[model samples]
Target chain A: MSLIQEVSSFLTHEADLLDQGNFEAWLELYEDDALYWVPSSPEQTDMKGQVSIMLEDVPLLKLRVRRLSHPRAYAVTPKPATIHLIGNINASEEDSLVMVSSKLIMTQVRDNVATSLSGAVTHHLKRSEGGFGIKLKRVDLIEAGGTFSAISVPL
Target chain B: MLTIDEINNIAGVDGMQARAYTDPDIFELEMDQIFRRAWIFIGHDSQVPNSGDFIRTRMGVDEILLVRQPDSSLRVLSNNCTHRGTRLCAVAQGNTKSFVCPYHAWGFALDGVLKAVPDIESYPGSFDIKDKALHLISAARVESYRGFIFASKATAGPNLYDFLGRMTEAIDNLLDRSPDGEIVMEGGHFSVRYHGNWKLHHENANDTVHPGYVHESSVTSARQAEGGVTPQDELVDRGQTKGMMASNGLTAKDWNAIELNGLPQGHSFMGGFYKSGLLAPQQSDAAIETYREALEASHGKEKAAKILGMDRFNNLVWPNLNVNAQFHQIRVVYPVAVNETIIKGYCFRLKGAPDEIFYRAVRFLGTLVSPASMIFSDDLEIFGRVQAGLETGSLDRLDSRRGIKTDQKNGNALQSTTSSELPLRTQSKAWRHWMSPDT
Candidate 1:
């Protein structure tokens, strides 16, 4: 497959895992050192000094996934239905690794409220034995500085 | 419009009227009486330390600009332009030479004086730029207590310190924590909105009984984290995140052991660092050690220990602000409407403290206050459910009579059981006090 096709397919598979509530499988797609970042400010780049909306490593992500499945996690008790639509894919590959950028419009519907979040997503995919492992997944939300309710589900 | 008697009757001894949280008219009255009359926290002096520096904030329901005057004094002015009631400055925060209205070229000085205007021939013969009416509306009183700024529209009630009362210690403790005895609001903030009454946030904050129940999922998830060999870097990550989530899992005995103090003026706080837990106030990491030595150098060892030993969970200043002094964070609540509220969480950077300690503060803030936080999301969920339930009007009033009979007077404030609903009652009583007619 072409670089664009391969990257697009990879993102699709990843989104399918999240969209279908297959969190356990989704965890395997990330490298141990992978970073899942959602900056709180539009111009924010550093997480150490400035707060981020979501800055989770693998361990935190696992904890989050576990909470989502917990019976008492009332925020996700109804189970939000989400469609993570990726478009405008731009991919460049070299040395068995791919650098990909895309636009993500993820819409989550739960308890009759449909909330849509759009962001520019950057992915660093490391070449691995079985497939590519996500080294970094940074999503800069368009409304990074806007007010929000509890975003119980992962984006 | 609710008469003062009707409004006072809303928040009574045993319970509060459901309309207190659901009615738009009552919300407006609250903006007028409680918010406008009381000392409402605006911005920190650290935010705008120099002249021309300013931050946009809200007083009651109206937008206001908290600016530093050319002489370095702070000024709180209504953000609306006097000409057409349009917003004078749309920027969230910035240093400015002057505020020029975007609609018309009417410029105002940093002190809110009408400086200049455009279209000389467009106005009526009575137009006078020098008139005070043409300038931005200013708050009747603006004062700062230890860099924490508060504004009062009424300008006749208690001064900032008097209004802060025992709550001043919460601010003092935060300031004293700094090795250099200074702190600045450095990190960006999280602005979170919930479709719930603003009171629910603070009411839930110091309520020891709700953490174990409202955040059971996160607690259980933390306890059930994979127990196999963890990676080296993930250890610190697991420790802090796990500690924060599990801290809410305190047993009933432990929760009861935690002392809750409700002061006059609706202020309350929780103390008693758990005797055993990851969040134990005594726990010292390398970062903490470094921070301690720095603090010791600035303040002698005894003073440093006293400062560090001041363990507090939530120091709630009535009606709006929640100061977590030990954690170096504060959450400010803004009432958007009857059923809506916005909360902004900010962490302070202690001057002369090791970067590691500040990083932990930043991390602690994210773990606890972020909208995506494991513990906080549940709280927000509960708040939404509360609002939804209250809007149904299934009940006329909400109960708050827990541990009231057990309360004993300590100084001028009422002291009650640690896990009781004393904070709620204290808040409601103050609500009644501020909502009543000024005789």
Candidate 2:
């Protein structure tokens, strides 16, 4: 497969894991040092002073996954059904790292309310063993600054 | 319009009537009597330090601009242009020369004076820019207490300090934590909306019994995570997330030990912060020690300890503000309609403290106030469920008598165990005071 095809496949696989609610498998696709960031502002530069929607390392990620799968986690009791559409895919590979940028529009429906969230998604993949592992995943939602109801699932 | 007896029936000491949360007429009256008459928190002085710097905020449901005047003072002016009544500013916050109406090009100075307008020949001779009526409306009173600003529309009422009652300690403790005695609103703010009455947020904030039942999933999840970082008895944040989640697992008996104080002005807070997570009164880290020394340098060691040792959570000012001093955060509740409310959360950065301290404040806010918070999502759900149930008109008065009998009067305020519901009863008392025919 060409480099673009390989990158696209990896991205699709990762998106599929989250969409299918297979959080355990999704957690495996990330490197131990990987960071997941959903910034509160696209213009945000410093994490130390500025707050973000979600900033988690491996331990925090595992904790979040655990919370998501909790039997009584009422946020997802009647789990939100989601479909993630990815387009405008672009990638560049250098040495041991590949950077991919894409646009994400996720539609979620639960309890008769349907909502769509769009964002600019960026992923840093490390070329390891055979395929790739996620070094970082950042999603900048267009409506990050706007008010929202409870967001139970990852964007 | 509700009768005097009807208003009395809506809110009381034992409980509150369901229509208090569902009646549009009462909501309108609340905007006039409560929000307008009370000293509502506007923002911090740190937000607008320079001339022309301004932040768009709310005073009740009225859109207002909290602007730093050219003379280095501050003014709270209605955001609507006098000509067409269109909103003067659309941006959330920024520095500006003057507010020019987008529709008719009428301009108002930072102090809300009408300075410029286009095509003066098109209007009659009666049009006068110098007339005060042509300028933007200003709040009747604006006052600052230790750098925290509040505005009131009532021409005659208690001053800001008198209205604050015991809640001033919450703001004082937040600023005194810094060695330089200064803090700024630096962290990006989070805004979340819940389909519920505005009062539900505060009623739930200081209520101690809801944590165990409302946030059971997060506590259980944090408990399952295997590590030395246990939230059960830990005083520090280890991975912080688990600590925050597990802290909610505090037994009912443990919660009962914490104290709750309800003041006469409808203000209240739950004490015993040392019992919890990152807010744990004890900081053992090297960075915290450095922060301690800096604070000690500014304030004597005894004063510093007194400052740090004072620990409480959710110091709620009546009507619509939650000041969490130990956590260096504040959540403002804005009423949109009878059933819809918007909550905005902001954190403060202490000037001389270590960056880690501010980062912890940001993290604490995210974990608890984010739209996707594991803990808050459930609360939002419960708030919605409450509004939904109340809409059915099933019950007349919801129970708030849990600790009524046990409440002890402590110098103009009522005190009870955290396991009680004294805050709601106190809130109802203030509600009746403002909503009565005499007021």
Candidate 3:
């Protein structure tokens, strides 16, 4: 596969793992210093100065995954089954990192209620001997400014 | 519509009727009597620092424009245009000298003065431009306590200070934590709309018991990750522990030490968590030392220690506002319908404090209450379920009778144990008083 095709397939596989509730495998795609961020506002730039919907480091991300996997996770007791449709995948290599951008439409169902969220996803991936690992993953939702209900799972 | 007798029947000293959370008519009555007449927090002074800077917010159902005047004072005007009744400002917040109506091209200044009108001669005689200024319906009373602004629609009532009563101490304690004795709304905001009555948000603010049960999953995970065996671990054996845990670090003794104070004017707060003179763990040792030095410089070390040692949580200021001194964040609850509520959370920065201090506050704001937080998601889930359950009519009365027998009357304030239902009971009493026409 071409480099672009390889990047697209990596993201597609990542989405598959998330949708299948395989959090352990999905988390393996991240490097030790990975940062997962979802900006709260469209103009949000400073993660430290401004509050984001999520700005989790590796430790925080692991805690989130642990909670989600727990059986007593009341927020997701029934578990939100999600399907991620990724399109418009584009990639560019800059130095040792590969920048990839894609649009995502995620539909989640829990307790007979379905919620559709559309957003832009950007990933900064580092090439490893085994495969690629995510250094930074940013998800910017279209409805970031509006009043969103509980965002239980990662986008 | 509900009669006076019916309204009285909905809430009492013991509990409240389920219909209070499901009936549309009762919500309308509450909008008029409680939300409209009472002093409601609109926004912070820092939101509009420059002249002509304005923000659009709501007071109950009515949209309002909070504008900063040339003199740096704020003017709360109706968002509707005087001419043709078009919505004046559509943007959430911006810096604009004048707002022009889209339909008629009529313009009004930041102070609600009618400035310009397109084609002035088009009108017949007797259309005085000066008299036609934006029909500014001023809030009956507008006042600021520290930097927090509150406005009431009723022309006759207690002043904001009188209304706040003992609640002012909570606000004072929050502001005093700042070295310079002031705070600014720094981080933007996180808004979440829940399928629950607005009252549920207020009630949950002082709820000390729900954290253990509702946040069981997070607590269990945090404990298991720290190599501590949680009670739930026996249910599901997930081996392999030892990692950085994400727990509140609150022990059973700490939980038992928490005291719930029922203040007058329907306000209450939970205390006894941060008696060691720190709000949460400081981000870094450098930040902690810098903040402490600043505090010591402004106020004497002894006084600053006392200010920092004030352990308060979830100061519910009746009807709508919830202030957290620990994190320096304010949450306002807005009722959209009987079964729908919107909550807006704002995190503030202590003026003259270190950058890490503000960052720590923002982190707390995001990880504790924001929609993305697992902790808050659990509460929202329960709130949504409660609203749905109330609609089913299975339970006629919602209980608020815990710790009532142990409550001690101290002046205007009623003190109770940590896990008491006194806060909810006090809130219901105040709700009943405000909802009554005679009051």
Candidate 4:
């Protein structure tokens, strides 16, 4: 497969692992220095100075993963089953920076109430030796500032 | 004259009358009599430390624009446009020269004086913008106490400090915990909407007895993750031994031995956590020191230790604010409906504490109250269940029969114990007063 196709396949496979409740597989997709950030602001240009809804180092991320899968976790009793559809993947390059954008629809259900959250996600992926590591993943929800229920896991 | 019978019949202590939460008529009455007449917290003066910085906030249902003036003073103005009554500012916060209305292009200064209107010769040339009629409607009274700002819409009533009563000491305690003698609002706010009433969450703060029960599963899970020890038992031993010392664990009897301190103005706290068998030694030490120094500075050493030992309870500040100074956080409740409520979690900087101290507080929020928090998830379930049950329109009353007649009254505040109904009963007193015809 071509480089673009390989990257696309990797992204799709990762989403599937999340859907299948294979959290360990999902964690393997990121580099050791990787950061998972969900910016609170739609126009947030930088995470270094601003706060994100989810800002995790590797250790914090692992703890969150454990909490989600823990049997005693009451929040996930009616687990939020989700299906992420990624489309319109656009890849570009500027000064060796590879940027990708995709239209995403993440349908999640909790307590039998389904919510389809559609957004444009931009991923700044840096090519590593064997795979691509995310420098940044920005999800611009059509509605980011309104009141929301809990969002515990990766979108 | 409203008899206690009428108050009880109109609304039970535990569950409220449907009209109190659902009916727009009652809301209007509350807006006119309670919100407008009472001194309500706007924003801390520290929020906008520099001139021209501003944040848009609300009181009850009224929209307001809180701005820092050129002289570094703060002003609260109605966010509505003076012209066609359009909302002057739509964004959450930002700094600007002067707000210009998009509709008719009317301009207003930051202090809210009418600066200009585009058409000079449209109406009478004698139209003077300097008149107070052209300015944004200012709050009836604006005042500050220890950098915390408040405003009331009605012209008549007590000044800010007088309204705060003994709660002023509570705010002082928060500030005193800070090394620099003052605290500022820090960290981003997490706004949450609950399926239940706002008062339920406010009342939950003073509930010392419910934490171990409602949060048992989360506590158990958290304890399990930490290996063969529990956090609560560790917390208690730390207080007696001082500094990271882990000793014998607490029994259910230990929880029963915890004391509850109920303060004036419907505020109360449960005090036995210091001796509880939960917190690690150092965690308990630092927390106790922060409380002790603040209390001692205001009152001597013995009085301070007494106050510090008395510290750990939830504070329900009159109408809407539920504060937990131990956690350096406050939860502000906005009632959306008789059945729905919106809660905003705000964390504070304890002035002079280390970054780690603040981080521990944030971790406490992370472990216990955040949306992803295990404890809050269980809380939300109970709130949701309460909402579901209340929708049945049944005549079932909320039970507050734990320690009713035995509670001591100190002015308007009620004092009770772990097994007491004082905190819940105190809240109902404030609720009744506000819901009355002549509060």
Candidate 5:
């Protein structure tokens, strides 16, 4: 496959791992220093300057994954069953670096109530020999004006 | 006797009547009597810190502009325009020179004075835009204590202090948590909707008895996660999961052992669980020293200790605001529907404290009360179910039956056990007083 096609497949596969609740496998899709961000405000670009809805380094992400999978995570007793639909994969070469943008729909179910959140996700990718691993993932929700319930998962 | 008084009376002991929740009549009355008369929290002074900066906030759905004028005083003015009553500000917050109404092109200065009208020649030179009739209506009373601003519509009543009464100490303790002797609304705000009576959440603020029960799953999980000999550990050890967290890890008999102090002006403070100090350890020392010095500077040292470490205080300032002193935060309830309430949670920056102290407040909200928290979600779920069930038209009354008679009456206020319904009763008393005609 071409470099763009290979990176696109890797991105789609990574999303599939998340939807399947295979968090450990999905964590492999990240570089050791990958950052996942869901910013608090639309204007927020840097985590140091402003708070984020979800700002996770690998260690913090590991802690969250540990909590979510624990049966005693009372908030997730039944678990938030979710399906991720990732589309519009665009890959562009910038100084030979692959940049990706896609639309995402994350449908979450908890205690018989279902909520579907639609957002645009941008992933910054660096091509490696095997494929591309995400350096950063930024998710911006369509419903930015409305209140967000506690955001525990990485969108 | 008018039906409004009778409705208010029935709501006295039962908390809020079903009619008040879904009834259009009671809501209209509340709009006039309770909202207009009482000192309602508009927004913090920090929200609009400079001249021309404004925040469009609500006082029971009546949108008002909380603006900072050129004179460095914050003014609460009706968001409505002077000409055609159009909303003056559309954005939530921004710095503006003057608000020009979109409909009529009439302009008003930041202080809400009518500056100009379109087509000045059309008025035959007889009209004066500077007249008092053309100025936007300012809130009847606007006052600030320690940077928190409250506005009321009534021209005559008790001053804000008289209304706040005993709860002022709770506000004092909150401000004193900062090493610099001040606090401001920082890290912004998080607002959520509760599909239940606003009073439900207000009453929940000091309902020390519910945490061990409604939030049992949270308390237990938190304790189990702590990996210690927790109250949850002991309860699970005794094979008593049902009442474990609800009992606050105490035995059923011990539940009756705690005190609930109801203060004057219909204010109440919960006095259980004195073991946990909400401030993080690092911030606590600096805060204490600074606060003691401040108290010595203001009052004295003995009074300062009495202020800072004086048990856990969760107090309600009359109608709409609840100051959780122990937590260094505030919950302001905006009644959207009689059955629906919007609650905004805010954390204050303790001016000269360590970042860990700020994190502790953030951690408190995240772990205990965030929507992602089962501890808080459990209580919210119960509140939702209660609101939905109340719609079935089955019962005329809700019960505040626990700790009713044993209450120590002090005329206009009362105290009971930790498990007592005194917070609800105290709020109801204030509600009745505020909803009454004389108010």
Candidate 6:
């Protein structure tokens, strides 16, 4: 496959793993120093002194995955099944590092109620022994300043 | 409609009726008696540090405009316009000299004085500009304790100090931790709406028992990851779960060491955990050292250690605010309906402290209290479940009787075990008093 195609495929596969709840495999897709951030505000930049929806290092991310998998995790017991439709894929590469951006529409359903979370997801990818690993993943939701219910599942 | 007797029927010592959480009529009455009369937290002084700086917030159902006047004083004005009752300010926060109503261009100065009306000539002779000045419906009483501002709608009541009672010490403990004795509101806010009664959020603030069970998954996962040998099935076992106290990095012994204080006026705090090194894990060694040095420099080593070593956790200020001192954030709860509530979390920056110290507080808020928190998600789930369950009418009374027999009254404060239900009982007592016809 072409370079762009290779990157798109990898992105598609990552979404698939998340949607399928194969969290263990998804956790392995990140570099040790990777940052997974979902900004609470539209133009939030600083993670240290500002609050974000999700700002997880590898350890925190692993804990999140483990919690989701716990049988008694009432928040996930009747799990909110999710489907992530990723499109508008764009990629650029320089010095073995690739920058990819995509539009995401994630539909999460639980107890017959469905919530559609649409956002722009940007990924900073680094070439690893196995294709690529995520250096940083930032998801900026369209409803940045709006009130939200429990965002139990990762977006 | 709930009758006076029905409202009076709420007993803090016993359990409360389900309608208290499900009845819309009671909710409206609460908006009047409880929210309007109580000294609700409006905004911090740091939010509007300079003249013309203003922030908009809500006092119960009424919109409030907290503006910094040119005189360097703060005024909490009704955001409603004098003419046609249109809302004067539309934006959440900004620095502006004046606010103009969008409907008909009626303008008011920063201190809520009438500035202009475009077509004054078009009005009848009865239109007197002096009387037409923006109806400055100021909060009956506005007071601040260590920069935290609270406003009341009632024209008469106990002052903020009397209302705060023993809970004032918790606020003092929070401010004293700062070397300069001040905290600046920083970091953006995180707002989450839950399908639950506002009381649930208030009660949960000082709740010690629910965390272990609700946050079992996250706590168990963290423990297992740290090489602890809790069996997967054992961790999931409902009977064995220890709630929040045992969750994350906190052990059962650490939970036991915590003391719960049920203060008067519906306020309460959880203490005795600050010395256990729970907060230490959230801070880097360098940041802690720097913050400690600063604290010592200001208050000397001994007193600074006492302030820094405070064990207070969630401190509820009666009706609306939850001050989490250790985390350096205040959560304001707004009830939209019987089953809908919005919680806004604001993290503060300790003035004169290093940037890393403030960042550590922000990190704690982001990881533990934000909507994305695995720990908080569990509580949210329980809140939704409780709301849904209340609708069934299967459970008429929710229990708050735990540790009641062991509770000891010292002056106005109630002291009990770490896991006591005294906080909920204390809150209900205040709820009964506030919702009464003759408050």
Residue B393 lDDT, candidate 5, scale 0-100:
69
| Candidate 5 Cα misplacement greater than 4 A, ranges | A1-37, A43-51, A55-83, A90-101, A107-116, A122-138, A142-146, A149-154, B1-5, B12-15, B123-133, B224-258, B276-308, B365-374, B410-412
What value does DockQ give for candidate 1? 0.63
Residue pairs clashing, model 1: none
Please estimate how well model 2 matches the true structure, expressed as its whole-model Cα lDDT.
0.87
Clashing pairs in 5: B212-B245, B212-B246, B213-B246
Docking class of 5: incorrect
Each prediction's Cα lDDT score? 0.87, 0.87, 0.82, 0.65, 0.67, 0.80
Q: What tens-digit string does per-residue lDDT give for candidate 1 at B1-439?
A: 5677786679878889898999998899899988888999998989999999999989778899999998888889999999899987888999998998899888899999998888767888898887888888788899999999999888588888998998999999999999988999988888888889988988999898988888999999989887443453332343677788988888888888777788889999888855555583778777888889999999999999999888778999998999999889999999999999999999999999998777778888888888899888888888999999999999899998888787778998987656789899889988888888862
Which candidate, 2 or 3, would have the higher DockQ against the true structure? 2
Q: Could you say which candidate leads in DockQ?
A: 1
* Share of native interface contacts present in candidate 6: 0.69
Q: Grade the docking of candidate 1.
A: medium
Considering DockQ, which of the candidate structures 1 and 5 is the better prediction for this target? 1
For all the candidates, what are their Cα RMSDs to the real structure?
A: 1.7, 2.7, 4.8, 6.2, 6.4, 4.8
Instruction: Give all TM-scores, in the order shown.
Output: 0.97, 0.96, 0.92, 0.79, 0.80, 0.92
Candidate 5, B94-172: lDDT as tens digits: 9998888999888888888898888987886669987887888888789987787899888988888888877777787
The runs of at least 3 residues in candidate 2 whose Cα sits more than 4 Å from the true structure, single-residue gaps closed, are: B228-238, B276-279
lDDT of 6 by residue, B124-238 (tens): 9987777734456778778888788898889999999888987788789888888999888888887888889999998887777776677777767766653222222221211
Report, for all candidates in order, the number of backbone clashes. 0, 0, 0, 16, 3, 7
The list of candidate 4 runs beyond 4 A from truth reads A21-36, A39-52, A56-74, A88-104, A116-146, B1-8, B13-15, B71-73, B120-134, B226-258, B284-310, B337-339, B350-352, B361-370, B410-412, B419-421
Better of 1 and 3 by TM-score: 1
**Per candidate, chain B TM-score?**
0.96, 0.95, 0.89, 0.81, 0.84, 0.90
* Residue A109 of model 3, lDDT score: 95
- Report the lDDT tens digits of candidate 6 across residue range A1-155: 78789889999999999999999899899987678889888888776667778876666677678878889999787988899999999899988889999999999999998988899999999998889999889999998777887788777
Task: Compute the interface RMSD for each candidate structure.
Answer: 2.5, 5.0, 8.5, 8.0, 9.6, 8.1
Error of 6 at B135 (Å): 1.3
